[model samples]
Target chain A: MTEKIVIGLDGTDTGERALAFAKDLASKIDACELLAVYVIEWSPFTFQTAEENERRHNRREEEINLAMSRIVDPAVEGLKAAGFKATGLVRHGDVAETLNKLTVENGGTQIIVGRASSDGFAKRIFGSSTQNLVMHADVPVTVVA
Target chain B: MKNFVKFGLTAAAVTVMSSPLAAQETPGIDERVNEAFAAVTGPFVSLIFAPFPGTEFPWIVMWLVVAATVFTIYFGFVQFRFFKHAIHLVKGDYADPNDAGEVSHFQALTTALSGTVGLGNIAGVAVAVGIGGPGATFWMILAGLLGMASKFTECTLGVKYRNEYPDGTVSGGPMYYISKGFKELGIPGGGFLAILFSIFCILGALGGGNMFQANQAHAQISGIVGDYPGWITGIIFAVVVFAVIVGGIKSIANVTEKVVPFMGILYVGAALVILIVNYDMIGWAFSQIFVGAFTGLGVAGGFVGALIQGFKRAAFSNEAGVGSAAIAHSAVKTKEPITEGFVSLLEPLIDTVVICTMTALVIVISQQLIVDPATGNYLLNEAGTAISTVDGNTGVSLTSAAFGASISWFPYVLAVAVVLFAFSTMISWSYYGLKAWTYLFGEGKTSELTFKIIFCVFIVIGAAASLGPVIDFSDAAIFAMAVVNIFCLYFLMRVVKKELSSYATRLDAGEIKRFSH
Candidate 1:
């Protein structure tokens, strides 16, 4: 039976590095299915205008497309080209929360994600998803530096 | 989460109750603030809203009326023709599952509606009716109908020239369109107009959107709970507003979208119930409106006063030509900009024609004001306006009196509605002000934060201060925005015309396909 591994992709070089490390680990394991998941951190609890709410469905679709094209696709392609079986998902939610749910749904045994990609002021003020996943994730989480 | 919010609110209520009972007596500061504001705004108010020679009409009112009339002719009355399509678009019939915008046609319209549909529909309408007589209702509807065309034109340009950032966010409104559209047409001074509009928007946002809402909310609260220091209500409002705004733009939109709809339904539903209950009087009330509109029904300002007041209130309430709706509409997701424009035209119609008229009908049907049976004219005070139901009065108090007359318990419900309406308007205007602020100062964390902090401070000031100067300045700022925005619209309207024509042609050819999903 293949061991399912969930990898978070953020459309950054750091994300690519995490995927590469995950790919290496999957090869070491006899049978493994790589699940590349990209989350477009959306908060249902957050405020929105009537306009934003009306277009919420369409915006959700766009966000998914944004995640798939900009983050998940490249990671999936890289894994597939490296001769591994892989699947991709684009979701709208809190990044850490969504990734954990995706892992449980996909029956993933472990999660691999990159370190915080940006050291910008915003990220500093609002902590990174990697830290959140590490603390709250049900499964084992590997943070690639 | 829900329990937490409930608990938090209970705590807040407790704090408000336990904290103060002594300050209401010394309203001296409030008086001084009012006087100071009155002084500052006094001259500008007269200058900006000066009546035209030989008429009671303000020149600013003429500016909007002329623009609305012109757009109506130029677009060949697109408001009527595309009215059906606009409704369809709002229903999400024409929306592609994969559109490029942030909000839907309906959401944009509703969001903008929340901003315009607030105090104006309630308090402003009462003011207009109280002064212009029942006849003002007729002129208001006319202005609203014509204003639809103006809304359509500006909103179309808003989407057409909107700046879509790489992060999938959008910046738009008169600022973007005036600058970008003019540049496209090889017209200079677009930058000048853009800056001017941004300045007015920021000022308007601070004054009308922030202070006025806070002041009104404080008044409502004081009416319910014996007066506290206005600053207390101001501080509370400022704190909540700050929290919501800090959560970002999505948070502001989310709250307004929900609260505005609920409040609108509550207020309008109450009005409908009153109207239905007084079915027999509805016809008589409307006849008064019609008669009063034409002959002024012996009210002061005669026929023209009613017309001017009605038009002014409608323009203020719906904001059709003020161009602020364009900012909200620009966020709508659509491949064709004109579709959003079509959707936007309904804003004024709903806000002014439907909602304002509902308010007017209720006020008229209440029989609270003294009316002469022989001439159907309201008994006027020395100043020549319909006498208030309450002594020394005007604004929402009069509306409250009317509603309270019909339903004894309604004043309590109305106080709640007033607070919610004021809150929603403040949050929405915060966004409008923020956008204009960013346009001038540039977008960054510090810049954004600075504007927001300033906004929060103004909320406190608005709540604490007297209504005179704060409201006057805000009114002037808002009208000033219209002055700059409408001026630019006149020049860039040809571009809007071209876009509308092309969009219409495409619609006729069935080239714009509706996505089933």
Candidate 2:
């Protein structure tokens, strides 16, 4: 009967903070089940090829796994250690849509992730993928710095 | 007279009625590009060679080839030994495809391959073989082999020093390793070298990756769209590329995963069809490759001199020790850096071994006998600049010519493929440069934005302006990066060796499990 929160994590530093806080909130509330989610970015390239793209995908998965292991795993483990229920999910499609899907999937109340992380490149000319995700995630969104 | 007019009108009408065919016949663009390359790269050929002046030091690549060949023998041709394993890696036996990291191994290879796999394989090898002859392919294969070790070392270091953010994002490459590795060595200039590497990377991205890519794309677009001013084509490409690049690595990965594969198949398929139809010529073409490599049949000078040209072309195309491919390999997602390193070894094989050979074979098979394989080069009659091709011609137009000979529709298809390949390559290189940029400068938003914007803008310049000096400077910067990067790799080969052995043991002991999901 507790209000469970669905948090969106795209694996940015800010997302890390949000996930950490969400785990704590879930442990305290006992009513909440934490959903750790990620959205895979797709473009024309992913849509176009079959086996040729797999070579790069494998390399990417290795890095992505390492990343999830570092951030989501610890938080997920921490919540479990405290006897709180936590489920981790990775979604492909647009970041925003996937995060929205997770909210409905979990009957969740909140989405948490990083704000526009400062890219050490050109500014004003670009927006972070996380920023794009935050702008569209329909649930009450929290961007942890 | 009335009958003649009717025939002329009918002919004109027929041409106008053909939509795609009409759109594809823009040889004018090829002519212009050929002229432009001659004006710039042609004149500088001797100059670029004059300064460092030794067939000796700067060309450590030659020795690297020797080293790689020796290592391959010592390890019992590990490239062949692990061939099956590499194939499995590509199959994602251990991959979940949806896993984190910016791209798939295949996509990463293509993305990296795209960056390394441009005209260098096509035009570069052509020039090398033209000047150096078939002996160049021998050296090229040799260099590529040695390049495997360098690729292993750099990619392993790339992952070893890589940073994974709390958001599950990763940032890595030579810049990270060069700086991090130096820090571990207690070297003072580590920071400076890292930044320098970054600057070189940015310059390369803009010039070689961005501008050059855009320039080639514009050439192709214009080929398809005659009278479409080069600048307009450049702007459109720049905007689209900007849109993708602004989204960062995932966006790049997302695009490349598809683009790289599509283009590779299209290119390879086109070449294969050409080779099949001309299957009879395969015998003679390869005969030239072996015979020209040693006897220097058509070359003016001795056999050794002609052989050197082949080596030069091979080096230019495969880029065995250049370290650019390492930048791509560093982005892989595995916990074991060596897995990616092993995967990294495939770049030269795919790029040089499979693709480059296809490119060469296409040209050699199609070329007229007057185009000598021993020194298969000549001056563009109008441009008066020395040019080379597998057939021993100078222009990318020659690539199209071969395509045209096999399939009636092939020239157009190949043109589109070349443009896409060049564009994807440039865009991918942009990321490599950006990582380096961030490495040198503080991770500030303004600095980041400025570089990307500048990089985007160069697409227009590359398309519209003179490529002569720009390409030279860019080539120098890229090759210069190899000098700096390889120096680090040589000193730090121990780390790569340790990782390689450890991973080998893991594989042997079944510590590394094959993937099910």
Candidate 3:
């Protein structure tokens, strides 16, 4: 069975670094498939009006399409061009929790994600998802700085 | 829609014109306004609180208690059966990664909690025990327990019938469920009921939710800073609440979703400390509660009185069958509507069962009531019950006196808590009021602005108005909401039952996937 390497991407320069690291690791391993996942943290706990709630389902579909076409597909195409068997997934949830759930469901052997670019007060208070993935992910997680 | 707007404007004009005259005629604006409000609200107050024929109890309390009991049995006590699952759902254990919502179960729960867990828990509990004695605490807990089932039923329907928009937003509550659920069942009166419910909800939002909050906050401030004109407090509250709510529901929800949890912990933690300090009195407190509940031991109106106060306060505190929480819980992200229902059971549990009970315990153990130790009876006043430690006090002041007994400076901390609690409740109710407003008038910028403007005006009105008619009218409006909402619940709860059983079957068979340990 081929080993699975899951790379978490956030459509940032750091995400490219994570992909590059995954590519390098895939080459070292004899047979491995690459799965790139990008998570959009959409909170369901928001308060919305009837008009807003009416449009929520359509808006969510648009977001997923936008993420897939504009973000995930382009990145996956890049990985494929770079001589790797790569697939991309777009999900809406907490970054770390979504990534871990995806990896476990997909039977990934290891995971790689980029460190958040901005280490400001907001990130300090909210905490970096990369750190969260490291602590909570079922699989071994590699955080690329 | 135009007519409604016109009526609102006329009412506003009357208030605005009267304010100047009242202020000019009487230097004491607060007293004058209170008198005017009392004059206006007196009849409505009597009508709402009128006792049932051949009974001393208000019919509305029986209405709520009976509805809660029926729901508990109809659902087979899902509150207990799914208690663990509800906790797991709140933790997002079964959440699908692709679910479309703006917040998690915990956030939704906290936001709903913020709305219900307000002045009712603090001042309302004190009033219950003050009148009904420690026995009221026992009945309050019982009512809270039964209320959990009502919360479970309405919230499930809230999510099930909620309208999910294309813009990643959601709107739900009794308005949607009554209309949609009734339509699904081929019922004819769904539209009328929805309209009626929306009207009551708007009134409730304005009266009980917004105005009452402003009124209470002003009262607390007056306790600390000498009596000032209420409009001053009202204007200040209006400005602050407007600032928060005008930012939209997300801004309102974000604040509540954060503040409510922290406040719950802080408030409950303080109560726990008091209970622990009075460790020796813990058993005695429970005995007093149990005895008071049955025999009305030294309490006014005896067992019936204790039972009435308990049920009334619990209904007021948790708002289980009121359908307001359905609006908040409807935004939860889950394909399984029953999961939101399960999570929502925690709302009444936290609000009435745990928090209200804690408040009652602290008051009971504080020995603040004028009880005669020699006879284990209350020192009765001319009205029959023991007088409050604080003269002429009914609500928060009584609770403050209770806490001030052990924690000398607790009243100061309580003042801050009251402001925050009032603020949180105001914002939450604004969202609720806004939803009902938009529902009736049709959703638009103009209509939305018009409703919000009226709501802000009520904040000022609530603060400046005397406690008599304003509070009574709002309380009546809040209970009036139940008349319509609980009626709908009778028809729609079977839908919730179906959803719950299906969810349960899937879970028991291990068909539900767990994403995390």
Which candidate tops lDDT?
A: 3
TM-score of chain B of 3: 0.92
The 0-to-1 C-alpha lDDT of every candidate, in the order given, reads 0.81, 0.62, 0.82
Error of 3 at B472 (Å): 2.0
Which regions of candidate 1 deviate over 4 angstroms?
Answer: A1-47, A50-145, B1-27, B100-102, B247-256, B373-375, B382-386, B390-393, B465-471
Task: Estimate the TM-score of every prediction.
Answer: 0.77, 0.67, 0.88
- Give the residue spans of candidate 2 off by over 4 A: A1-145, B1-77, B95-104, B129-135, B185-188, B221-232, B246-257, B299-309, B312-316, B372-393, B465-471
> For residues A5-47, what per-residue lDDT tens digits would candidate 1 score against the true structure?
9999888888888998999999999899999988876543333
* Candidate No. with top TM-score: 3
Return the DockQ of model 3. 0.33
Clashes per candidate, residues 3 or more apart or on different chains: 13, 39, 27
lDDT tens string, model 2, B134-190?
Answer: 545655665666666556567668778876665445677777887788888776677
lDDT tens digits, residue span B373-449, model 1:
68656778875555535454467777888888899889898888888888888877888998899899998977987
Error of 3 at B465 (Å): 2.7
Q: Considering only the true interface residues, what is the Cα RMSD of candidate 2 after superposition?
A: 8.3
